[model samples]
Target: MSAALRIGMDIGGSKTAAVALDDAGTVVAATELGTVRGDDGVVDTAESAIVALATQTGVAPSGFASVGIGIPGQVDRGLGVVRNAYNIGVARLPLAQRLSARTGLAVSLDNDVTAAAIGAAHLMRLSGTVAYLNLGTGLSAGFVVDGVPLRGAHGVAGEIGHLAVDPRERPCPCGQRGCLETVASGSALRTYWPAGGDHPGRVLLSAIAAGDAEARAAYDALVAGAASCVRLLVLALDPHTVVIGGGLRLLGAPLVDGIRGELDLAAATSPFLTELELSARVQVLPADSSAAAVGAALAGNL
Candidate 1:
């Protein structure tokens, strides 16, 4: 008899991706679709994506053992509900239950970043305490302890992006001022850049490379805020590794190098900081991998 297949879907703000994995964890097929707004739309999109993947893999829906989903915003896995996903316009949705009803398979849901952390940990073969810092549309993090992403008491343990890091009191959609995300996220950087630029991050990086003073200052602040986030994670959890991922990670070496420079400067003045070895512990996720979807599939097995 053939091994049962597992389906994993990553419900992102702009796009939804799904992957079908055989029992051994090898991806058999994948599909992508643009996300639709509203609770019913999102659920329909997820169901469609899974059907597409199953078709691509030449397997019937009943061939899958389970379906796992990674969604942005607050999710109650136990209840299979998405409490609030502002980016995707879904609020208090019974995502898993709805998807399960549509696909006739068990469904599991988790925060997208947490699913990425689980995938990153598996990809890197990391054990013990690990941190996954995602600098995507908004900044957030996921903590994994002993190979399981720590969801915390309220399932918000790694929502560090909202922590206030700047004294300037910049407004945040989360109704906070000077949250780390307000200064360091991709969305925040676009707001900081000159209006009408086709690519704000690239523009800022190019100007910084050209030694523009204003661009340098702005970029410096972003790096400083990110380094502070790393410091906070290190101090709080002392994780064995801090893996950086998400949209901003596309900046590649320049982004990692900039963060390292900031931590190095701080370590020079504080022996405790030096002891943490923040620079050495930091790593970036590999390019061209759909980590969240993979992790969601793994979550199903778990």
Candidate 2:
């Protein structure tokens, strides 16, 4: 039972990942599992992940120093409560308290995007300001300034997705029109290319290759929206790096290249944007990297 070991869990809409970090902050053991929906199901799923990591590391769950969780939704870190996480069917839950009571360890919670931002800075060994743009089920940005996450006064700092930038004014679930999210996210893809089905990013490239006009249009909009986010982050935060993360990042190099290309195109006219070097600062989160989970663990220590 190593008291130095710490646990971090990232509970996503469809998947859950857990990792155990050694005293030196290196990941020693990790596991992934399907996330179960609803309050009890989420708790059970988290407990199962803890058990799996504990077994792998030959340490009891209670032996860990603390449990940190990165979850989607409005997280009340002070209260250890999460609400409005509709993707996982968690309307409201005292996640940290529940998990702590179950595991007999301290627990902390962070917004999933903020956690990823912190993890990206740590893993990439980046210093100075870093802005993490999450292009996933929804669009959002997270910031880490000199290794400290900027969660803002009310925890709504990086919610640029709802800015309503589109002239057409598409409706958003947040009750807004023309939100950047409505044009950029996975949900946006589903709406734009309904024939592509639930997970559009997976099949989008192939569809583009097959000459599907609709798919091409949707992909183009996604690229444009993402580029807009990068530009917005730079103009606002002037971050040293802007790391693109989240599920759509699975689209890989093509997606990154498209974003850079868009930025370059925009910079072509605006010397202001050119000097900022927006495209050069962009980087993609590595595939299969447990950034959110790792960040969760780090957040616990902070």
Each candidate's number of clashing pairs is 0, 0
TM-score of each: 0.93, 0.98
| Per-residue error (Å), model 2, residue 247 | 0.4
Against the hidden true structure, what lDDT does model 2 obtain? 0.92
What is the per-residue lDDT of model 2 for residues 1-302, given as tens digits with 9 covering 90 to 100? 57788888899999999999888778899999999999999999999999999899999877888888999999999999999999999999999889888888898999999999988888888899999999998999899999899999988889999999988799988898999999999999999899899999999999999999999999999999999999999999999999999999999999999999999999999999899999999999998789999999999655
Considering every candidate listed, which one attains the maximal TM-score?
Answer: 2
Clashing pairs in 1: none
| Least accurate 10 contiguous residues by lDDT in model 1 | 193-202
What does candidate 1 score on TM? 0.93
Residue pairs with backbone overlap in model 2: none
lDDT of each: 0.84, 0.92
Give Cα distance to truth, residue 221, candidate 1, Å. 1.8
Candidate 2 Cα outliers beyond 4 Å, as residue runs? none
